[model samples]
Target chain A: MRLAIMGAGAVGASVAELASAYGHEVTAIADSNSAAIDPNGLDTEAALATKRASGTVGDDSPESVLEAEYDVLVEATPTTLGDAEPGYSHTVSALERDRHVVLANKGPIAERYDEVRAHERNSEGRVSFDATVGGAIPVLTTIDDIGRSNVTAVRGVLNGTANFILSRMAAESLDYEHVLAEAQDLGVAEADPTFDVDGTDAALKCVILANVLFGGGYALSDAAVEGIREIPGAALQLAAEDGQTIRLIGEVVDEEIRVGPRLVPETGTLAVSGTQNIVQLQTERAGRLNISGRGAGGDETATAVLGDINRLL
Target chain B: MSERTDVRAHTVRLELDDEPGELLNALGPIAEHGGNLLSIFHERGNRTPRGRIPVEVDVEATPERFDRIVDALRQTGVNVVQAGAERYSEELTVLLIGHLIETDFSDTLSRFERCSSASVAEVSLTVADDATDASSARIRLAAHAGETDRALDTIREVATEKDITVISPLTGGDAV
Candidate 1:
């Protein structure tokens, strides 16, 4: 498959780097300001090096990459809320040309599912967003394998930054601020860290899961979210005394999406620690299924995008 | 025969005056109502705020007989704290984080008990050394079977009113 990637962020760059290994060609790649396009094939290493040294990928406008010839357009851009901007428009442009879209961006699919599906219904292109929900955890694909109707509920620790803080607080008896600062220093959490810690990141993932499980009509605003910011170290101590621990859990059950700090057994499957993620699917026939792994990072997320492209083939 | 088939386990919590014959007096109503005695957990040392001993009596009886047993106990002036069959078969544990001491923790527990569908079974509070800092409490609630959602909703409401953050147990999954 010839892939055109939008947004030269970590995930996008990693996708471009790993595309050839997965038997795919990078026809075009674009960052916010510049574009590197080649109808035949672009040098992945050269483009990435240019992005590293100079602040741009190439001299071409970012808009030109959308028009480049490609079999799959990987939307690996930064996630935005509400309008889900440039990403949504870029997705529509690809779908308008009947090009398949593999999304690493949660914005378009999380905020605008029905509209994207409506476009897909008219066009021959299909959309796959396995990378959006749980990085490389294959949460959406697992739901697909189990059959959407057969899966009753989906819950997990979808965000790494929140989980890191909570687990560190429990293990070392540290406060939220201390663990969060440590996480930022270790590069496990971003500098701002608002979205990941405030439950918005996990809520967006849950909203995306709700949209998948219930077949659209759910958005970020529809979710009831509470962050782990207010949880003091005393809470973790109380939980640990009872043989349980606190985790930032996102749940999509019975058409309701909720993300908040939840209690799970200390040794339970959902109690994954230190930036790890776990998704549990309640299947009607198969009982319960748990899938856990590194739920973020550029290379891990790029694998999901590549997997989606392989599926398109 | 049908009544025998319908018999189920029911628990009744009672506050009896710490006096001689109080245990025998509580047992009299169950025998009179055709309720077979399953067990009796008489906590002689544990007393309620009113200075009465707490007793947990388990009985096996039909729904009709259970209702009559409860009524007979109440009519006999026996203080029945809680009574139902399968009403609290499920337990939910949640962590409450915030100024628990400042917000009157006892009042919060009483409000939960007042819901009727749930009862505060156990609580462990951890207070910070700094008096004004936030405290945390682990509360175990016994809720009616299939009514965990209602119990959670009630908890959320009370917590919201008191400006507390609730870390609820993940439900609908056996792993947690």
Candidate 2:
């Protein structure tokens, strides 16, 4: 398949690197500033090397990347709330042009799922966003296997930054501020970590999952979101003494979506440590299916993006 | 016609009140929901504690159709005790030693039975003289191919909560 990749960040770069080996073409790639497009497939290695040397993917604007001819549009842009920006417009443009879309970006789908679906309905292209929620954990594809109607609930540790902090805090018996500082030093948390630590990231993922399982129109604001900043170290120790550990769990049942730190049995599946993500799908007939893997990282997210492209094939 | 590739064999156990049309009424949902009946085992002499007759049914249908069949059975007021695969290829025996009755042994068994990946094939209980004394149970569990470890982990979690000790073979297990 020919692909036009938006967002030349880690995910897009990794997708460009891996797409050809998987028998797919990366015809175009764009960063926030610039883009590179070629009708007969861009030189992925040269494009990536250029992006590393200079901070932009190429000279073409994001709009130009969307205008390029490709069978699938790989959206890997960073997520932003409200309008969900160039990503949303880019998706609408690609779909209107009768091209399928594979999203690694969560903004357009989470904030404006109904609008995206509306565009997909009229367009010849379909949309798949496996990397939006659980990175490379195959959460959405697993949902596809059993059918969405059979899923009763979706619970997971969606954000790696928050999970890393909480797991470290619980293990080292450190306070939130100390752990947050440590995470920042380790590049786990962003310099401005409000979106991750405040539960918005997890909430966004949960809202997207709720829309997928129960249909569209669920926004990040619809979820009951809470962060782990207020969870004291004493509470973690107390829970540990009781053979339980606290994890930042995001759960969606029916239309209700919530993200908060909950006590899970230490030996249980949800008590995953460090920067790992786990998604457990409770089905009406298939029982509980648990899948865990690296929730973040450029290459991992790109693997999911490529998997979605292959699924379209 | 070519055979459907997605079709799977499913078994459903039902408890029906002893009535003239109860047996016929119970089979209606299976047929109505696109299930092709393979066999039926109706125990006429044996009755459940509720005085309902126990019946076991084998049918072939796709997963979606099987879900519909189960729903139809419930809607028609048939007691569907179990509706899934009959044979779990992998088997393991675990022994739980503790206050079995106090920790709710029945609940433990129910949890193991509820897991779709595994099935509680058989259980044997050994009770001490007094109710206050500790007791033990040897549970034989069967799981779908390659799901025995997951099944064991679930049992371990339940055992940990009930303050029971679990003992099982680490290796030398095969599919039943």
DockQ scores of the candidates:
0.50, 0.01
| Candidate 2 CAPRI grade | incorrect
TM-score (C-alpha, index-matched) for candidate 1: 0.83
Model 2's alpha-carbon lDDT is 0.82
How well does candidate 1 score on lDDT at residue A252? 91
Off by over 4 Å in 2: B1-176
Most DockQ-accurate candidate: 1
lDDT of 2 by residue, B17-131 (tens): 9999998999998999898787798999999999999998877677899999999999999999988865567876665666878887767776664443465666667665677
Worst 10 residues of 1 chain A by lDDT: A304-313
Cα lDDT, model 2, residue A293: 94
**Residue A165 displacement in candidate 1 (angstroms):** 1.0
**Total backbone collisions for each predicted model:** 1, 0
Candidate 2, residues A166-275: lDDT per residue as tens digits? 89988999768899999999999999999998899999999889899888879988998768775656556655654556778888875788787765666778878899
Residue A265 in model 1: lDDT: 90
Q: State interface RMSD in Å for all models.
A: 1.5, 14.9
